[model samples]
Target chain A: MTNSEIMTIHQALFIVMALAVLGSAIFVVTTSNLFRAALMLILTFFGIAGLFVLLDIGLFAVAQVLIYIGAISILIIFAVMLTRGMQGMVPRNSQAVAAAVTAGIIFAVLLLLFGPFRVTVDVARWPVFSLFAGNASPRDVGGIAWTPPNQPIPAMPETYIADFGRSLVDGNQYLLPFLLIAFLVDVVLAGAIFIARQRRPAEIIEDRRRQAEEAAEEAEAMRQAGMTPDVAPLPEGAVASTAEH
Target chain B: MDLINDLLKIIGDFIAGIINSIFGFSPFLADLVTMGLAAVMLCTFAALSFMGLTYVERKVVARIQDRVGPNQAGPFGLLQPIADGIKMFTKEDTTPATADRWVYNLAPLVIAVFALTTYAVLPFAPGVVGTNLNVGVFYIIAMGSGSIVAIIMAGWGSNNKYALLGAFRTVAQLVGYEVPMLLNVLPVVMITGSLSLVDIINQQTTLNGNPGIPFIVFFPFSALVFLISGIAETGRSPFDLLEAESEIVAGFHVEYSGMKFALFFLGEYVNALAVAFVFSTLFLGGYAGPVLPPYIWLMLKAAVVFFIFMWLRGTLPRVRVDQMHNLNWKFFVPVSIVHLVVVMALMKLFVTSPALAQANGGVLVTPGAQAAILFVASLLILIGSLAVVARRARILRLQEAAVLEQRRAENIAAVSA
Candidate 1:
């Protein structure tokens, strides 16, 4: 494609992606059900990944997917189920509304401040087309582009080797923060445990009792129907050894 | 439209030229670049292979206790992990039957991904970083917390008592240590005056007349806090209640096996390596040492720290869960904050203050006199604090022993009656 045509395609992609991102973000905030909100948030992440792609940060796009879609989205859904707060009829909480409004105002302020300056879209006209041609995967573009000018682009072999060597000892630059983040992960883990432990014992007991009653009722209904109750196996080492037998 | 096209062409041509000129005409250069890209690809794929960590732990623990771990596998247990991998993949990957599958699956992957991705921003060698983010330090801290959600999910989703309990403990430990770790880093940041990893290293690159004052020596108390917190953060021995195998089993990864389990394992080792890497870089002056390639020195530094981790694992028993929390909240947190303040003040006085720099033989090549003075004062402070703590502890122990003796006498009297 000619440079102008490439530019147009890029611009179109960005606009579409941006709109999708905005729409998903809106849905994420506006959805009455927490589960649906979490789903919408996933969509928003995907949209942001697209924007990263548009910015020629393919590495970042993949990372966004690897971390957000692969990890964070799952986390949100897990949290929803654990609290069981996402269940039942959709109630629009005033707090959620306030949060949405606050977010909207901040977004509006940001747009007013930075939206006037146009983003340059010439990056699309680069030999990015060649990158996609001949079955060249998106993952290869980073290493081939690292060399000095006028060299033939190298073809990286398919080796799933991550470089942990240079990050530590590269004298000109250090990977201190990367290392520190690992510690931070530990700290965050500690904090999460502390918070989870704060749940009152009474609340826990009540929740368990309610769940047990529901299970017994389900089993009784199945017996009346002249059918074996299809129950999941009990976890190992528990008083509920009936499932094992 | 023509003018815009002309501008675009100029920019495009300039970029293309830069790319071409740098690469040269050699396919070898292309091969090298491809190799670099391949390394990143490996990291992504290796992230998937992180499940081996669990297998490794199982086997290692077994061997340590005079038993073969997973010996039933393909050969002296080499292919045991592979077998386990297949088992996990084929077995019904149930979502606790009633648990949150999305979060359940996502938690392991999240932990694995964040653990791996942090490597991207690290400078592997000079000019060899995956992404060289400007705010590398802050980004690491912010993104590091992203994994908390995943661990929480695992705990809540498993719908099992043990799983939930383990997850709760893991999260608490992770969060509690974060404050001290960040606070410990502040002094280094103060000395460097930038959160960029490159800038921090640059500040400490010299020995006699190199990068400046090794930030560690400049702020020894900060270094100690960073070291102490770093150890706590890794959940190593004396702090590793998270996965206390005898107690919590595998903790958050208790139910995980195969590739899923591997991700958690890899996350852990990678985390261990990453933590050691940071500790070495910040306090040991990164890759800066005499008579060695910078990268080699950096690795050696990290290796030393990693060995220390292993040594602690081997030598020290795990602290009780309550003690772990108390240590972080009661001791490390306050100490870290104070260290940051003290070091910041020191940096301001030494590096930034022109008069102080002049008195100490200039900023870059300051005499040992200033450092020696700071060292002596710190030594005195440390000794005083140690003395106070020892004295208090001795009195408390004596009082506790007396109380214990009284209780023993009461027990004997009851038995006689």
Candidate 2:
């Protein structure tokens, strides 16, 4: 960090990206427009990816972009659009203070846990993460040797991704959580399809007939009121425009 | 090996010398100037190539459709792209009355920036690249994916139904095809055991002085899937559901005009070029050929791949939206996943050890034998998947026929009554 210049390039980039991430995060929540919020969420994701790049972990940086910005944000935008009555003015609520306080608390917790300040409160416990071991010796995590506390963290090996990949399918290491996540995704997809399942032909016919009767009744009411009874369902196969603008 | 022989390296060193010695600047200042110069060079290269690519595409597509393309411009349309650029630059830039101003203005720039960022990790030749990030391939994919956000922004900002619909299809197309695209890339990464493009290229043949088999010979199916998915990713024909001119009327960019619209065009061609370069690097042994400079070889390879892209665009008709989704989900995604898994498993089994592979010599089987085995494996998987696809088609045809027959019977009965 020490340099004759005002700041090192890495420090400058880190500050810029951190500000971007934080600013976009606040904008995402504070903005009333759901679409704009989704876009801002993408910027937040991108800035976090920038932070990961600054940390020189290209894998996490790309993963952040690939998964969060690529997939999740798109999904969020889709949800925002598909739900009716959302694109209009969203009423402002009185929860800004609560949200800010909660966010600050989470940020503080994250900083204490794994921030770049390098002052992790539970650094020793994080490797094997055992409370019952009585601090005798640190157990290695996935066969990776643990660095003792109060020394600089060693540079990660080049093949860390390969090691991580191997552990995902290994007999012991992340196989359980990985499988659980896969199963959860499977269930979620199935649940989504079930929720959006089409109605049966009989149900559709009954609904159409009921709508026709309702329209006829409305027409009669309009006629009794001495106005033209022009209100009726449009022809089938017509699209109802739901454009936001 | 020396700067004198490597033209790019020499030019780079010259820039550094001028910045450091001639200017007597601090190291940091010199570095900054060097970076600025490099960025300028890369941008100039990108802009020129983009112009050239647009001209080439029109000419090729025009010839494909039996038309003389752009002959009215300078020297058989050599300067047509420049003319087109001027036209685009001068075109009236109009904003929708109710459009989201900032998002509308920024989307094109963002997409263009994202597209340009992909070149940073691409290796043009040995020791000649923007940055050569360790996770180069992944980084490129991530950068390319950022365009989805720009596209979404364009759609939402336009305040037009067509634009919004285009954005919707973008999500369906890009997100769906990305699975197969990543899976297609997995075989190359698994074979090389590296995400770095240079490493992948070196793994193909050019590692050390020995010439080896290009990965395409080993994973031809992966190459095919990658090209198809790459085209889908680029929003080109047969998978261009995002635009679907007949339906969405130019899709997300319907409202864009002038240079802003041209930026989207730039993003597209740049993306297509990136995909081609990536394909050549992944499969065609980038910069690894006999009797040519490495970057020239890489360019030739990329040009061939790019021509294939143009050829496919000329030959194929846009698929129906349902067909696009079906092709991605029911066919490409599952097939690519299986292909990746099989390749990974077989490669793992055949290669003796990572330590041996790393040593660059020891292996249970020679590279030739491994390539043969991989080729056979890929052929088997390809054939099996195609057969399954055929069976599915037959079943769907029968089901469709049954429905048509039932409808006909109902109609006949009603008429008789």
Candidate 3:
């Protein structure tokens, strides 16, 4: 099929992304397991990324996929897994209710805001350049290319498309917002660090003590066993120690 | 109004005209040409710059340390980058047995793409952008954010704790710094009233004759904020906590070897250049100089910032992560916000004033009562919110003190018993 035809065909399947988001959201709320919830939330982020692509903000789409899906999602999943006593995390009813209410509000707001905005751009009207043909294809030729009599045309920008590097970082319209965001992020970082520190000081102290003790034990063991103290195999010996425990 | 409508009509017609020109004969052919050109440009720039940047960074760093860098390879180590490239090519490509092969391979490609892709909307010279796409700055911000994800993928895909730790530090640092970096630019946007980089540069040139009041020079506080935040954004010293060699063992790319490692290195330098270039342009009267061509001036500006980055690498000690966040939150963010307000006020008082506006080659910013009123109201709102929070905190503190006193008495009685 020609590029236009493919985009047209894929247009309908775009709803699949929406469905995935819905499914993931449900999973996030309903799943009792914390890890499962985090995983589902990651899927939900992916779905949102897909929606960003559909919205014509390809940069935002990539970012959503990369940041929310790739980095933030992983960090969250790590945090969830790292949380002590995370097993048997029952899905809370209040969380479910909050999620439901939030979703309803978002849907209602979207419907109310965008329902009347008539979008005139049609699937057929979108500029879809066929690549296989050595020349620009006419409408008739495009039709032939999509359901070719024999030879297929090359792909268009839309088909194997990636909009790279369209954003400028120095525009006046963005300068203040950029600075503000930097400042805001700084605040968040400080707050996160402070909270993390405050909550985990005991854990931090314990962790350090354990590590120091382990190191000392390894050194003493190495000396006692007549192994070179300089080449202390603490990392290797830790595995054996854990096995013994 | 008629002129604007006519201009808009003409622009629409021009686009329609171009579409018509390429509409017939088989659109596939046109696609091939466009895509082919894009690919060629992308590869050529990325490949050439990657090599050049590697050599430049090493030599520059070496010089900063009062040592000869790569002089053995052809004329002041001009061919060193080439030698390094060849070395990478000849090295035995190895992947860890425990690594996720697909992700491990994909990590470098994603990093390189994210780095190179940032150049798309950057204007090297007037009317010489890759594509003057709308919302260009926003796109860069978004793409830059994507790079963090790629870093995480690299870290995770490597299956090494050091790499994971590095990636975690990086993600936290980048995400954390991005806010102030963005905040510092808001005043510029407010003043210029356009998102286009070209428009901003053009605006700068228009202020050529003005003394000590170049758009960027005028907003000294914002400029400093942008530069500092830009340095942090690019993960340069003293903010290079993520990839501290002694700390996280080269951070996320610890497991990557051979060409993959090379790609990460290349991505980093290019990313630095990109940030420096953008930062220079945004806050330093980009490409604005006398006794040089405009493009030359642009290059000079970028080079100056690049030098500063290198100098920073040599001179400044890397800040601890806690200090980095503290600097960002307690100082940078609030100060930047206040700076923005001060600038906005200055703009209102000077640029908006009919008398002084014309003096600095600026269009008179007509003082609107609505804008002034809104500004005042927002300021008041912010103050009110702070007051409420402070009161609540005070009450909580008092309650805590009372509880502590009661506990002290109970403890004394227990001791006596």
Please give each candidate's TM-score: 0.61, 0.83, 0.60
Model 1 CAPRI quality: incorrect
What ordering of candidates by lDDT runs from best to worst?
A: 2, 3, 1
10 residues in a row with least lDDT, candidate 1 chain B: B1-10
> Which candidate ranks first by DockQ, i.e. highest?
2
Cα distance off (Å), candidate 2, residue A132: 14
| Residue range A134-156, candidate 1, lDDT tens digits | 24442223222323356433543
Say which candidate scores most in lDDT: 2
Candidate 3 lDDT tens digits, B1-417: 433324433543465456547755656555545545555565576677667766777788888898888899999889898888888888888887777576678889888888887888777655546666555566566667767767866876676778878877887788777777777777766666565677666656664333213454445555666787778876777888878997988888888878998888878777888887787667666656565655566677887888888788877889998878877876677766776676666566546545556665554543443234434544554465457657877997999999999999999999999
Model 2 lDDT tens row, B279-374: 999999988887777778888999999999999889999999889888888898888878888887778767745576676554576667788898
Model 1 per-residue lDDT at A229:
82
Better of 1 and 2 by DockQ: 2
DockQ of each: 0.03, 0.40, 0.11
The C-alpha RMSD in Å for every predicted model, in order, reads 16.9, 7.4, 16.8
Top model number, TM-score: 2
Candidate 1 per-residue lDDT over residues B172-267, each given as its tens digit: 777677677778787666555566677677667743453455666665666676676767665666777777788977676677655676566666
Q: List clash counts for every candidate, in order.
A: 48, 0, 42
Error of 1 at B29 (Å): 17
